[model samples]
Target chain A: LAKTTQPISMDSYEGQEVNITCSHNNIATNDYITWYQQFPSQGPRFIIQGYKTKVTNEVASLFIPADRKSSTLSLPRVSLSDTAVYYCLVGETSSGGSYIPTFGRGTSLIVHP
Target chain B: DTAVSQTPKYLVTQMGNDKSIKCEQNLGHDTMYWYKQDSKKFLKIMFSYNNKELIINETVPNRFSPKSPDKAHLNLHINSLELGDSAVYFCASSPPTSGNTIYFGEGSWLTVV
Candidate 1:
């Protein structure tokens, strides 16, 4: 599995845009970058995923540059409820095999009102 | 309906006791996983099973045993639990190919006194 690096913590005010970046310099060829959001007492929820370029959903947007060495998750107009730990994972897909993606200490985003 | 459901949302037991956390997913997924989240809120994968077969087994303790009766259910049994075992255990499931977007159940908080 490819290891990922992200900020330990970030702070953002309500109605502001927050971007959390993750670096995976040794990302594999078939690796896809995915992000998950975890609240205090709840399970982690899938936020966004991308292989390259940009992928947007109703909740967040994922931007991956051409190098694919890093990706960023952008949350627009954040609210206090959006404060959660965001995990960045790089999925390693081998030739017709199952692989489990590893999770690191995610970026804890604190959205303050 | 809850896609993934775990029984006994909170469990408190003394050290050297044995306990099990039952999990069931109604999403018709073929793969399920067990993860442990520590007090510092770092999520770690313990084990994974696909179609009733063990696939991913991390460096978890031998006291932690996972059993999958079928694809939709995975139960974790911990024997002779210790104080360090007091943490939130989460059950998750996902499609075989869509490994990036895993659905996690509300965790089972275990307190080993």
Candidate 2:
């Protein structure tokens, strides 16, 4: 398990791009970084995940540097509905083929009008 | 058709009482997890079960017991609930491999009165 550090909160306006960075200095060789988004009364939804370099999905893009010590989650053209808490997790596959990701305090992104 | 669902969306119980939150995932995932989100909104992994076997158990108290009857069902039972136990409990499931996306259920809000 790797510990991750991220900003406590961020502010973004609608139609703007929002980027939240996470630092995982002790990331393992086999670890993968994943980002999740949680709304007020709903469960956290998977946004994007990447092992290295970059990976993009319909919702967001994840950028991991070559060193793998940090990663960034980019959400484009944000809307008020995108205002939520974002979590970054780093975990590796265990022998049983299961990964128990550790969650941090997460970054609260407020998308304003 | 929600992939993951938990019963009793909100539970209001008294101290020393016992309560249970049932969860089922129809995503055909092999691993299920229980996570706790405190009032301060810090999410922590409580337990993880893979194919009905306990895979990860954090330092949570014994009063919080998790039972996985099968690959698709995991239930949490809390005994002698205390005020400190008031928080949102989320049920989630993921594939057996690492770096896969995990689906979460709408949390079960437990209020210990």
Candidate 3:
């Protein structure tokens, strides 16, 4: 399992775009980078993921460079409701043999209005 | 419909007691996981089960046991719970073949006094 490092917290005003980055120096060849968002008193929700280059979804975008040692999660047009903790994970497997792996402390994004 | 759901959103119990948190997923996925979030907000993987078989078992205490009776349900039973067990427990599910996206249940806040 690769260990990930990210900011503990960040703050931004509503309607602004926020970019949070994660560092995984020991990422494995089969490791994929994923991001998750969590609100207070709630579980972490899936955001976006990528192996290399970039991947985007309705919620967020994930960017992984060639080295795959780092990734960035971009939340466009933030809102106060977007204030939550964001986690960046690098793993070889998830639930089952699918996309499950290990997750680390995510960045806390405080979207202000 | 809720993709993933957990029971007893909040649990307050005394130490040395036994308690359980139930999780279910309606996404028809084959894998489920249990995670613990400490007060400082660090999320760690405790266990992962796929098709009722244990896959990844972190170095968690033996007091924490995860049982998956079927494909969609994964229940966590903590025996002789301790004060250190007080934290937010999250249940997540994902298709065994999914590339990145994983669904998460709301969470169960367990407070041991």
Candidate 4:
């Protein structure tokens, strides 16, 4: 399992882009970086996953450098509803094809008006 | 219809009480997990079951037992709950593909009095 480090919190205004970076220095060759979003009383929702380079979804975009040591999650045009905690996870598949993604102390993003 | 649903969205109990949280995923996924989010908002994986078999069991207490009767269900039973057990419990399931998207249930808020 790879341990990830991220900012504790971030502040942004509505309509602005928010980017959260995660550092996983000891990432394995087969490990993948994934980002999740959690609201106040809901479960964490999957945002994006990537190995290297960049991957974009309808919700967010994940950018991973070639070194694979760090990745960034970009949320475009943030709104008040985007205020939530973002988790950085590095997952490794076990022999039985099980993926137990471990989450760190997520970066709480507060989107203001 | 939600893909993953858990019963008792809110649970309030006294100390030393035992409670169970049932989770069902209709996403046709074979892997399920139980994660605990503390008050400080740190998500930790407690148990994981794949194809109705226990695969990942973290260093959680024995009082926390995860039962997977089938591929679509995973229930968590906590015995002799304490004040420290007051947190949010999330049930998540993933598809057979490793390191892919994972769906989480609307957490069960457990408040121990």
B14-83 per-residue lDDT for model 1 (tens digits): 9999999999999999889999999988888888899999888887999999999989899999999999
Model 2 pairs whose backbones collide:
none
TM-score attained by model 1? 0.95
Docking class of 2: medium
lDDT of 3 by residue, A5-93 (tens): 99889999999999999999888787677788888878787778788999998988888888888888988999888999998877755
Off by over 4 Å in 4: A92-98
Off by over 4 Å in 1: A92-97
Where does model 4 sit among the CAPRI classes?
medium
lDDT (tens digit, per residue) of candidate 3 on B4-113: 99998999999999999999999888889898889989988888888998888877899988999898899999999999999999999887653557788999999999
* DockQ of candidate model 4: 0.71
In model 3, what is the error at residue B3, expressed in angstroms?
Answer: 1.7
- What DockQ does each candidate score versus the true complex, computed on alpha carbons? 0.61, 0.75, 0.57, 0.71
Candidate 1 per-residue lDDT, tens place, A1-113, comes to 47788999999999999999999988888767889999888999888888999999999999999999999999999999998999998755433465877776899999888
Question: Each model's C-alpha lDDT?
Answer: 0.89, 0.91, 0.85, 0.90
lDDT score, candidate 1, position B69: 91
Name the weakest run of 10 consecutive residues (lDDT summed) in model 2 chain B: B94-103
Model 2 misplaced regions, further than 4 Å: A92-98
Note the residue pairs that clash in candidate 3. Answer: A87-A106, A93-A100, A93-A101, A94-A99, A94-A100, A98-B96
Minimum summed lDDT over a 10-residue window in model 2 chain A is located at: A91-100
